[model samples]
Target: MVSEAQLRTIIAEAVPTIDAAKLPADVAFADSGIDSLDYAAILLALQERHGLVVPDEDLSRTASIAGILAYAAEHRSDA
Candidate 1:
């Protein structure tokens, strides 16, 4: 399973300029300053890093870091 730390790291790498300390675990990608393009980038990065396919619907619904983590946990086996 992908841990919260790993998820945070992934998010950090995807948007290096963001202050991770201000990013809440439950903060949505949009709320954290990650727009549609950034979200797509994050999804692609996750797929490339873990060899898992994140559904577009799921990606669209990922509004917060917690949501993303939950999605990752759900798709961990596939990864």
Candidate 2:
């Protein structure tokens, strides 16, 4: 199972400006200056790294780190 900590690292890599450890889980990425492009890249990185199939309709729910963690928990593949 992929832990939340690993997800945090993935998020940190996708948005290089912010330190994931310092970021709160519930805060939106926009709070940290992440734009739409950054968010999209984050989604792409998650899909590529973890083989997660986050539908377009579901993408809005993943605007925050905690949200991403939740989505990954539900949809992550057993790779």
Candidate 3:
């Protein structure tokens, strides 16, 4: 399953400007200064690497680290 560490790594790789290690778990990307473009890159990386696609309707469920983690735990697959 996709874990927080994996998510952080993805974020770090997707947006080099953002320090994923210091990112707050429950804070939304907007609150953390991660713009929509970078956030979309992170989401794309997650999809490309982990096969965890965040549907358009599920954007709210991935707005924060905690929320993304929860969504990954529930929807991430190893296939």
- What lDDT would each prediction earn against the true structure? 0.73, 0.77, 0.87
Off by over 4 Å in 2: 76-79
Model 2 Cα lDDT, one tens digit per residue, 5-62 = 8777877887788787788889888887778888888778777777766788987888
Model 1: per-residue Cα lDDT over 2-37, one tens digit each? 666766777788888897656887767777788787
TM-scores for all candidates? 0.79, 0.81, 0.90
- By descending TM-score, how would the candidates be arranged? 3, 2, 1
**Which order, best to worst by lDDT?**
3, 2, 1
Count clashing residue pairs in model 3. 0
**Cα lDDT, model 1, residue 56:** 66
lDDT for residue 7 in candidate 2, whole number 0-100? 73
Give the lowest summed-lDDT range of ten residues in model 1: 54-63
- List the pairs of residues colliding in candidate 3: none
Error of 1 at 14 (Å): 1.5
What's the lDDT for residue 3 in model 2? 65
Candidate 2: Cα lDDT at 26: 90
